[model samples]
Target: MRAADRPADLRRDLVVSGEIHYFRLDPAEWADRLDTAVRTGVTAVATYVPWLVHELPDGTFDFGQRHPHLDLVRFLDLCAERGLSVIARPGPFVMAELKNEGLGYSVLRRNPEIRAAGWDGERRPETIVDYLHPAFLAAVDTWFDAVIPLLAAHAVDRGGPIVGIQLDNEIGMLPWVTNRPDLSDRTVAEFVEGLVATTSREAVQARYGVGATSFDVTDPATWGPALRSPVDEQVLALHRDLGRFTRDRYARYVQHLRAGVRARGVGEDVALLVNIHGCWGERATMFPLGISQLHRTWADGDTIPGTDIYIGDLDLDTLPGLWTSTAFLAATCRADQPYGVLEFEVGSGDYGEALDVTTGPEAAGLKLQLAIAQGGSLVNYYLLAGGRNPELFEPVGDGNDRIAFTGERHGFAAPIRPEGDLATWFAETVHLTEAVTDAAELLRAARPERPPVTIGFVVDHYMTEYRYPGSTREAEFVAELERFRGSGPREIMTRALVVGGYAPDATLLDGPDALADLPTDRVLALAPTPSLDDDLQRALADWVRRGGRLLLSGPVPQHDMEGRPATALIDALGLDVGPTHAATPGRTPFVAPSITPDGPAWQGAEVAVGFAQPLTTRRADAGTAPLAHLARTGEPCVLDIGLGAGRVVVAAADLPCLPQIWDALLARLGAHPRIRITSDSRGVVVVPCRTPDDVEVVHVINVSPWDTAVALERDGRPVTDEPIALARRSGTWLVRRSGETRARVAYRPPRG
Candidate 1:
């Protein structure tokens, strides 16, 4: 491919990257994963700098400072040998399910005050070290003081392979997926400093046109209460003011860490990134508008300008919601640095140490994540080759507090076993890395724009419900909403727009000012809550009258609880009626047994569409237009009709909130261009290097002593043998075509 056709270089973007834990996999295997990484075309490697492991207890520090297995220096040497880059995670509290919050037993038992506080003023037993606490900083300082210097020297800038340093693991509870406990006097103090420095009650206000005098002049504690949501809501809004407070303050802490890494000499060349809990996307918060307070800290920081990448810990393989969530983060960057998937799921292995079952080898999740992650700079996977988490070294607490010995919540289902079992999952990862890294030059340059579909949605808000039990009232509803989450909203919008024969891809970011070349009267059915902004509202109004079509499943809302009417826009569309309630409550059969819409929009996927009782409407004009209604006992609860030259679709029920309904509705929206690849849910997929001359030189396997080959696809064309490797033990094979393009690979099952 030519230069322009080649994708942008996402930080060493290779699919075959592996995860190596600090406390796990014998250091001896370090060379093995590295060699496998190279043969697999893995350009980068990721490892967590477990605070608990290095610090052992407070005041003490260790590296290979004692054991060669613990040797940090030699590890980088291996990375350099293989021309691999590194992503380091040093968490004062890296909760990879370590005992005592990843802090060696000493920190937890000795530094009780550092733990976060609950609403009751007692320290939460689950966490260790208040994120912003000074003592915590001092403790981390003791660790960084010893190791960061070594990392700084090995950073890519210094001709070594270390490229990115992750600060803290995942601040948000994530995946199965905290409290903003500012109860610590230190947090309160830092909150004051941050407000004074970045806010504006005079000193506090800058962009939003608000102002506060001194930091103390404003009651910051009140800010927390304003953001309170139901316990079921896993996320809280990081609105501008509060967002600034939380973000800027958190930025201060990151800055401290960044500086320490820099002082050690890692400098600006080694990028610094913060990982957000992917579940944060479920929080229902808007971007720049509703990013959680904790996320905004890194998401909106200017401390380290060039280091503009913000990440999230999402194993997006099976969960479609996380795909768009990661994509959205890339969109929010001021500098538009590449979006990075800090912790892509490698496999469905263990949830917690207790769950000893493995997820799968095709790593079905990585397939889609890379599609989005490729939009930016880098995508890294953790525990690329997990062995055992170091022996709890020096038992820390209530013997029950062990992450390693217990395994994941389901079981110890890692791609590679702690006992060094090399499953097919590991082989697949190696194969994927080889394909991606070999073509890194070209693949890195390709930028696949989201297809021209108008059926996409943003990912945010609603994490709490998925991670744990939600409020009794909304739990079930919440769970259902996430059903079709893995399928992206953008994809839905694009596909519908495309199949409908519209050029939505060219003018999707429409309305008015966004792109004037587009027509003004195009309407889209927006599934929104009261959170829609005034600007978007105004834009929608202008476009509708100018001939845009809008099919609101509900009404063009005119007011919020504050009773403020967003009149200018709502009045123009003239949708002033309230909803028609469903009769018979839960028994309402709104879902039609077999309802179908015109064209490809409703193609594929199974959805239930029910008939409804017709309801009354004032400005209803129906002729030659499509009408879709969902109702109760023949009474119309959802009504779709045209208003002026535009359309208005309303539903009394928020069933579309359910994953099933949402996906079906999206299908009817339209179809887009996509190349489907079948993959297993091993978490991480494999990529391999190939040339016309070496098309038949790869192999892969699944489980019980087997092997196979991964294929390669380019601009809708394939160019090599499918990739292949070994299982928990090992295996091998040869390619078929030595110089032909191959789009997809089909691996065989291992012989029992």
Candidate 2:
């Protein structure tokens, strides 16, 4: 964002590194840890300097004063000495599970006002603090005053090792501050000031659909409690103002903290990154709110102070975690700059479960590589390595221990040990990092955010909480959760995208893009909740005419969120929901579907079972291609005409069609231009990083911990009827190939 004219060039130059609390490691072992990191070919090293670790509220600051452990300059000097840049995070609210680290526990216990109040007005210790509280900002400013000079003096841009400086870790501390809890008088006053600047009280009342003259503008305290519970009038009145307030809160606080960061004298161009908690992964209701935040900040304003590709936080990370979430960040980031994964599960620990999913070393490498392979220009592996906890000064949630979770205390179990010895996985990570450095350019070039294809988020699972108000656990409801059902659609479509045989730009959509008429290569069947926006429905209709291939299924949308009769676009193609009968399994292996086929119907494929008495049948206007048919089940699978430039296909049944068709269908979908590689080779992860000249650097990793070899076509050659070896363990098999080096595949040796 700083180099507005030089955005791309600036992003391309970033070399994201990993983190290990150098202080946590014994000084004796720092050398080895540093060596492992350098050997890994990492560009920068990241570490957090928690206020709790360095200062105890009374204002005394210590930088390794007495013990070598507290040594600050020595650590920065080491990074510079090692030629590794550093991402310095000095948090007054550093929430890396450090006790009293973020909002001092002592403050929470002693100053009850600092704690977030619950419904009963009792302060909750978990995440104390009013984020917008003036007192809190004042406190943060005080902390910044001391840390900034040390950092500024040693900043990488200043010929020192420090490169990027992150703003306050995660923003809001009081989600409890939502509808519950009185908006601390300080926040309410600021709220009025914000409203005054952004909206007039008269306008606010008008928007809230209330009597314009009824409310007095003198005080906002009345507004908070009155508007907390939504009235239809309030929804409209507060929608824009509410968004403005939150953004103002974010911008104000961030601006407040940044004042300290900037006042320290660090180069203005040095990036200031902040992370948005993937609040949806844990509590999905938070997504719309985050989106609103997006609408408030980056989307509209050019002058707003912030970097692009805002870092998104995720608590649950799976292979295809949430492309919607990932892509959302990409959209915001790419619009301004390149995407970045500010926080991710690199070392691997969950709410409390440590050392469970090794993800093996290959998995870790796979994510980082793919991230770069995706449009993530820079990635920060949260805990490149962990060390001793400072003490659970303010243990939130389940209380703190050595590690904060039920298991280990002291965020331990890192690639680098507390003493700094590299773990077995450490070696794999080294190899992976080396692979990335080997192919940085290509990864940047092949970023999905910049790609052409749009990854569809069918109305299925991820947003079920919002999509269908009361439908949570019912069998059919669960079946239609926006994410899960839509996942199947996304996977198949992604196949076409990857197989389309070129490095296509991939954009993810959980909300509506259909209206954008985004050139659809293919719409994967993500069975989003049978609800879609009005604009999306209209978009798909235009897209079909303009030549877009749609793969809509799972549950063909039958309504908008309010459940009005839907399927306007596909209606012409014969897509419709049948009866609401319980379409359960019958007694026979080959159950007869309710329909009789019109022609050859399918290519020797028999239908197993159809929808619960409901079938999407053709109207007189529908054109059909007999892709597949099940006689016994009487299910007629057709390829609808008007695939825009191509054709539209709908499969009312789950794929793999009786285990016999998995390979072929997968192969076909893989080759489909619209389908991208939704599967990261689950068993074997293949991440391609392109070199400077666009030469692809394929990092073939055998995530399997034990030694194993994989077969893959190399240098664009045929499969050789056998896979190319992945070699034993963390083999950093590099290959140069054509079209992404996708053909330069990856797989592990099969178990006996």
Candidate 3:
């Protein structure tokens, strides 16, 4: 085939795909199902190959010898004949509500060591197997030996329809509860070794006032919340390090799976896709479970980690968070790779109770459009065609038959229903797929442009939410090391910025490389913690020196990641953080501060909710200016200091709680919003994207219950002089102009 016409090249463009389970449906319906998929403008289809279903009790495997429904090879052949590519998810643990998460019952039952253990060295609530366990890997090796050869033969390079291989679904989700650094013997050994290697015996003695011989990694109590008390800084450091250690294990598991797939002759050209569950703004802070720290895990070039967004319903509060999350997902992945929403909300799902709202066609269409605008080049609905769960039979006896874990005919609101008929959402699905197909060229080259303002997403701060839930204030602070910066500031900044008519990018601050990834012209909203790493501290100092405006929240870093006193950035900026102060208790009102008119705009604005004993910084530079002060104490709350070509704004109070203050800071930095939405309606979002032909297209999404009057602007000029009424829970593509001239533009709804 010609290079341009090759299937591999075609995979790079914007494509619509949906999950279809051949194993769950009758073989007679396969042809009709494939036909329906094509009519929906789907270039690809995806399915999970469950190991539990394929393997029999007698140590023998069935490749559709008895039942055609179990015929994966035949299904791939049908897709190839229909000209639809495939995304095959062959999991030893596919947690699609399957019993034992699709693992062969005998596998875990025979080897208890492979099972994930909880805090007390007991089995977790779910039957999730540890990925790196040697015996479990051995079992996977056996399964891959049989299954991968069949999958490899159907890959596009080998002239078949398979174009992608999903490497395990939602890694780290199994044991995401509190005390979750699986206390398996192997895990404990690794954790202790990591701590001893990175930290010194002298450092440990200084913090704990004890010898290194007293350290114990195997004791579950040592890892509990008691160790986090402010007095026990040494244990707090160890606790935080354990979270890091667990993160490494998750990344290595991906590497192992990718290696296993490649070793079986699966070509490199086929995409390696992994998915993360729930990393949507404030919702992502529900960490250790639905969400995980994506920075350390998805580093391999062959692998592309996509976010799994299942917004049951669209509300005003959910819209911006979703928008922020999708942008965060795009930023998390490599810039060049096509952004993906591997499992978007196709319809209402059930988790014993109805997990989603009644998502009609309007809500469905708007969700897809917003995803595309946020940089989703590849979109896959979780269940394109809903179907009945298969009744399993074991050779051992009738008692061994497993009931359907997700209930019979699980998807009641899927785009395609269980009876080979279209659901209410079918029309919208068709429209979106067709639109994506028509605009593939434009969508392929378009990426989410970096906003002029951004709030840094420090992973270490967010990942530590699972610690010290019930500990006293002092203990919790000590247990988390000096780095107890939680999601409060990060969440507030994102929400406040959106409310202030600015959509800020979430630039990660995990390592030095993250600094280079940021757009230098942008303003960074950073709430520094005492536990900032030495490398990150230097990077932030360099950013301010390079003329970037740094917005500070809580306290400047007085210590490094290990709780060791280190302040390279603090010294560079010529500021010293003084003693901490806390508000008087018994009243919810934290701080009521008044902004000074002498500073930036938004002065005289009211500030509610005082910060938690934040440090007061003593400025060493004569040029340092105070912008705002606490109403009660008359102490400076907002301070600005000039550093080299740029400037830094440090707020003694939490910046997020003060929106008007953020508005002033943004205005002072001279940051202009790319697009502004003027609407009283909640959950109305505007996403601007540039097509390959340089056409400016804005995706307007109204997720509210009522119709909203929305207007768009570019460089302060309104695309339309008057506001357009967006229907309730609907979406549309608004094109600014048709031709090359950037002059006087005429508006028109995009052709679907």
> What digit string (tens of lDDT, one per residue) describes model 3 on residues 1-752?
01113343423677677899888788889888888888887778988888888887775678799778889999998888878888888976787777777877778867888776544354655776668888988888888887888999999999988888888787766655334546666666565555656776555335444333344344544433223332334445555665677778878887788899999999977887887775434233343223345444566544666667776666655554565566555556665665577887777544344554354555556767777777777788888887777777563343434534666775556778888888756876787677766666665665555677777766665455334333354345544432324323335655566545566666667777668756568888765666777788889888788888887766567776656788888788766655555445664324444444563435444455445333345555576766665556666656777888888877666544344566676766767667877787745666566756666766667667887788776767776667877777777766645663332222222322
In terms of TM-score, which candidate is strongest?
3
Per-prediction TM-score to the true structure, in the order listed: 0.66, 0.71, 0.86
RMSD of each: 9.4, 7.6, 4.8
Model 2 gets an lDDT of 0.49
Report how far off residue 572 is in candidate 2 (Å).
7.5
As a TM-score, model 1 comes out at: 0.66
Once superposed on the true structure, which residue ranges of model 1 sit more than 4 Å away at CA? 1-16, 56-58, 104-111, 174-248, 279-319, 334-336, 348-358, 365-377, 391-397, 400-412, 454-525, 530-536, 542-570, 577-586, 591-626, 630-752
Candidate 1 versus truth, CA RMSD in Å, comes to: 9.4
Pick the lDDT winner: 3
Order of the predicted models by TM-score, top scorer first: 3, 2, 1
Error of 3 at 378 (Å): 1.7
